[model samples]
Target: MSPANPVAGDERRRLVEDVIQRRILSTELRPGQRVNESRLAEELVVSRTPVREALLRLEGQGWVLFDHGRGFVVTPLSTDEIRETYPIVAQLEQLALTSTGPALRGLAPVLSEINGEFGASTDPARSHDLDARFHRTLASRCGNGRLIALLDRHWQALHRYERFYMTHPDDHRRSVRQHDAIVAAIASGDVASAADQLVDNIIGPMHVLLERLR
Candidate 1:
């Protein structure tokens, strides 16, 4: 082979990361569980190098922790982390929506459509995706790069927690309603109200987890 393909290796590494990350988020790889490099490499049909690289990157993202040559273990979900992070995400999203300006005002129909899909979604994974798209669409227009990056980072944990919490029909309906309210607020050009909804929407479900952890 003429010079090992660096690009192929990078792509394979990303593929490993995506699959492993999904398992982590979906709880197939529960918190504190060990990650077996050999098992994963065989399962993924790639060499160990890419899998190892992917795990290292995920460690940087706080998704896992190294066990000092014993390989990586999935990081445990923390109520404290949720309590601290949700508010920060909420406040930053508020700022993003408020400063996003009037362009989003005209995007009501698009937002409403997404909310409808979210409500009608039957699959858990699909619902989670639609839910993210709904928020991402609105925040995409926020005109602030730094705020958006932070929101995306925090959302990694938030998405998994929300998925875990939104298992009941009641929870799903409630979330859909909250999403609708946020869309309506944006449509009416009331950034304050929309931002307010954003904060409450996040904290409402979070409060339940907090209670359970207590």
Candidate 2:
């Protein structure tokens, strides 16, 4: 495979990265699965160079790991890793909510509408995307540029776990309920309470997965 246009190298790399990321998170490319650059180039209709560039970036993000002799493989995912990440993200999200204060009053209704759409959506991937959007919307109001950037980085890692949870019927129902509580707490300008709800919404599922792992 060769490049469509030399000038579009960066764009091709980015496109390949996003598709590969999605495939990994969706479990289409399972953990530890070896990546074939020539196959990817053929499948994605691009040159091997962009796939190489994309894998380099993904390796940096911990989405894939490269072996000097073996090229790249999807990184293993585990409940333990997600269990460690959820509480930290929850705390940061809470701090962001607190920083927003009364400015959050109007956001509840919008969140509620999104929550409704989330609950009704039967597509697991769409549901997962909506769930991330719900939190990212709140993160935007955190008013701390650096923290938002950090949270955004970790959010990508969290998506695979979130997608797992979205596949569980009981978990989806619980998510909707927790989202309601979170929205209500935020709408009332109770940052501490809203933060607590946020923590429960995230860490609760992680704990469930942990128990299952045990």
Best by TM-score: 1
Q: Supply the TM-score for candidate 2.
A: 0.92
* lDDT values, one for every candidate: 0.85, 0.85
What's the lDDT of the predicted structure labeled candidate 1?
A: 0.85
Residues 1-214, candidate 2: write the lDDT tens digits. Answer: 9656766888999999999988987889998898899999999999899999999999988899987777799887776688788888888887887788667877888899999998898888988988998898877776799889878887877777788788888888899899999999888888788888988898887887777656
* TM-score per model over all chains: 0.94, 0.92
lDDT tens string, model 1, 4-54? 899999999999999999998788999899999899999999999999999
Which regions of candidate 2 are displaced past 4 Å?
A: 1-7
Residue 99 displacement in candidate 2 (angstroms): 1.1
Pairs of residues clashing in candidate 2: none
Residue 174 of model 2, lDDT score = 91
- What are the runs in model 1 whose C-alpha is more than 4 Å off? none
